[model samples]
Target: MNVLFNTDKLTRLIANLQTFTGIRTNTFDAAGKDIQLSGGHSDFCRLINASPEGHARCEACDARAVEKCLTARNAYSYRCHAGACETVLPVFESGTPIAYLVFGQLLDDSSVKQQWENAEKELGWYQGDLAELKEAFLRLRRFSPREMAAYAEILEALAQYIQQEGIIRSAEYSDLQKLEMYLDRHYMENLSLKRISADLHMGTTKLCTLSKKLSGGRTLTWLIAQRRVNAAKSLLLKSDEPVSSVAESVGFSDYNYFTKIFKSVTGITPSAYRKTNRS
Candidate 1:
């Protein structure tokens, strides 16, 4: 992973993955330090601080084993933890393992009996009657192998998304940035995709397509609306500006329209939001 790329981007990507696919997301460095985590799928934080016997031995063992495998792999990949439901997938950009995308947590369910023999050996446990363990494992819902494969495919898609983002950043053209900055400066003064596109020497349609792709569904108008709404939030928070004035400051000509949109996006009227959230 590039040190220049901060955790903010990775965190945001994890959030996106969770939204797009119902799977947990996490990122660990090449040396196995967790950089960002979402979905709260692991108890590593608590486990690391606890005494040996009380801590999460299974999670610790799995993380250590995954790190070892990652260290040895020539390409980005992951090995399924010898457990019933969990599998770790590594996200690679240009053959360098930058992140790990772990999914499939159906380990505790029906898989126990099906994989009982295998998991016991993998965990280095004696094959005594696992009736007690099975009882405990049955508490959580289990997924089948097919379901696990579906989750793996989702993880693979997320990896491709992160990879595409890396490729875009590496290219690092200033056209998109310039267009956004220009909009920020002049959105209140009447801006259009045609004008911004002309300034950037890009066709309007192509610019719109690229902008939508980069923004994850925000069109030019929606982006402008978001900026205006964000400005409205700041004004609502900072000074005691009237709603109408705040709307004007944020490039919203119609106070009613601004209020409607703001309420739609935030689930509360600006006045109510300011009152509740503002200091």
Candidate 2:
């Protein structure tokens, strides 16, 4: 049984999980768009951003992670091209692959030092580059094989949480499902309950009732916020647009109000989110 994820709830839960484990988590949709857990990139990831070549190498690591996770049908761990250990887990419900959860980007200090020397001597790393990375390299989190295995267990449990939280009776959402899909497609537009009701050819009262039921007690406004905020996240990460422009692009006209709602939804300002998540 496929399910459309509740992005807000799962993002909040993933945030708490990251805090608990001191490990990062990221989720991506089937289309490869990040829907939740978009930030908190590890220092190993940062080091790879030092150059275009290094960034390409980092992409290789990410591709490897994705392939391993999907192929294994469970958690997959490997040493990244940047000398850090990483893991990814495929998220599936009822045999349909919908998303992925990635975790554990950690570097061993000694391994990093050796790789740094090798990079400088063989890979054309600049004179001051490796030195500049010393701090973040030393600070990069490390985990043993056994520990990563344990983290995989924890991630397995959390993956179940996302699946279970998304579980709702399908019979109750026939009309609501169509509405939900429409909202997801057009959430960037100026939408209203009245407009939606008219388009659905249903009475306002009936629309409101069905909306409440579909949202599990949330109003349609909540649905809008969820869609817009997630869209804002993708924009903030994928481009260098200004926060105000990003706000407007996501259907939030008032910059201040957008900042307030963005912080409320993501626990960080738009600027901070971009800074943390940008490649």
TM-score per model over all chains: 0.42, 0.53
**Candidate 2 per-residue lDDT over residues 126-163, each given as its tens digit:** 32456656666567787767878888888888777676
What lDDT does the true structure give each of the candidates? 0.62, 0.72
Q: How far is candidate 2 from the true structure (C-alpha RMSD, Å)?
A: 19.3
Residues 183-260, model 1: lDDT tens digits: 778767667777777777888887887678657878888878877888788889998878899889888889899999
What lDDT, from 0 to 1, does candidate 2 have? Answer: 0.72
TM-score of 2: 0.53
Candidate 2 at 80: error in angstroms?
A: 1.4
Clashes of 1: 1
**Model 1: ten consecutive residues of lowest lDDT:** 42-51
Compare the candidates by lDDT and give the number of the best one.
Answer: 2
Candidate 1 deviant stretches above 4 angstroms: 1-6, 16-22, 42-50, 53-60, 63-84, 108-136, 167-279
Tally clashes: model 2.
0
